[model samples]
Target: MILERIIPTVLSVRRILRADPALVKAYGGDPEKHTSLGLVTCDQDDAMYVALDEATKHAQVDVIFARSFYAGAAHASGRLSGEILGVIGATEPEAIENGLDALLRCLEHDACFYDADGKRTVTVFPHVIASLGEYLSKEAGLAPGTPMAYLVAPPIEATIGLDAALKAAEVRAVRVQPPPTETNFACAWLTGDLDACEAAAVAYAAAVVDVAAQPRR
Candidate 1:
């Protein structure tokens, strides 16, 4: 198993309502209106990413930065760092709080990596977004309401699994994360009809299991 379900969620909020000019501009944030900040860390990196996108639809927020530490959360640089750090910005403290709440809710019910087979060691994350939210629409460069299959896994598994996913459904790969990602994983964002996206996710899960069962003889 890549990781058991003992991962804890980390969210640290700072009262930067109206934002700090020097810090905002330094981070390439606009020097305009009000803004609050939220610092988030998660054991599962890509899972938090989809939550970030979902949060944007629930609240007026922007992803300031989201990064996975080199390697994974188990070998993190410090405590509470998790496998990733995602920062978000909003016009008000209340909006920031709402966005964070939305993120937590989505993470709990919507997104997380999983073992490919029942009680197997293979790991994969295949999520089908029924409709694109503001942030995900931008990331996929598609309009809202588009269905997308968000796929992620370790390098070899992801690469091969995506190939299977593409062949299984009539989908388009809108965004592909090549090997050696920030956390040494790979990912792909596929867009298509809802049914097609779901099919692709299923195919991806199957492919991950196949890869893990490779013969080493």
Candidate 2:
């Protein structure tokens, strides 16, 4: 795991076995396989996606729901609401516990934004999943074990960064989210071999840093 990171701390955690039927239906939980729910909140919305992906790898859980709030954690609905709320469902409470462990560990260790420079406030997150987990595979509509370059940054930075990433490596653009996101960011998801995805992520980060270094021509 990478040591240098701006971690997204988890603000809250909740587990519910035998959740209300209506709530379970809304969460898309299967009664048989997803009888328990693991709900969590994090300060950064983008980081929660990574946490959920890692959670799926560690337990028999499905990411039932995840959504980012408008603005960010600074404008959250409540003190513990944070910037995003994500929920996973499993067959039993033990599976939920395992999945939660992965989610918490992920937030504590990795899946974070990085400072573009030691001085500037410019921020970026360019991540490569060597082998995507089941949750992200389903979310990205790609097969499991496929490498994914998950890139996110401020709107303009992400747009330019993704362009550089595609040009630097052989990767397919599986998804592109433009500006005006809940947190006012943009994102792109690329799929390729591990090496190619890694290259793309590096290129993305370099492009973002370049933009931070020179805002205008």
Model 1: per-residue Cα lDDT over 36-80, one tens digit each: 777678788888888988888888888777778888876888877
Whole-model lDDT per candidate: 0.80, 0.87
Candidate 1 residue runs with Cα over 4 Å from true position: 1-8, 11-15, 117-121, 215-217
Tell me the lDDT of candidate 2. Answer: 0.87
- Stretches off by above 4 angstroms in model 2 are 1-4
Ten residues in a row with the worst lDDT in model 1?
A: 2-11
Clashing pairs in 2: none
Candidate closest to the true structure, highest TM-score: 2
- The digit string of per-residue lDDT tens for model 2 on 105-184 reads 88888788877755536678898888889989988999888889999888878888999999999999999999978988
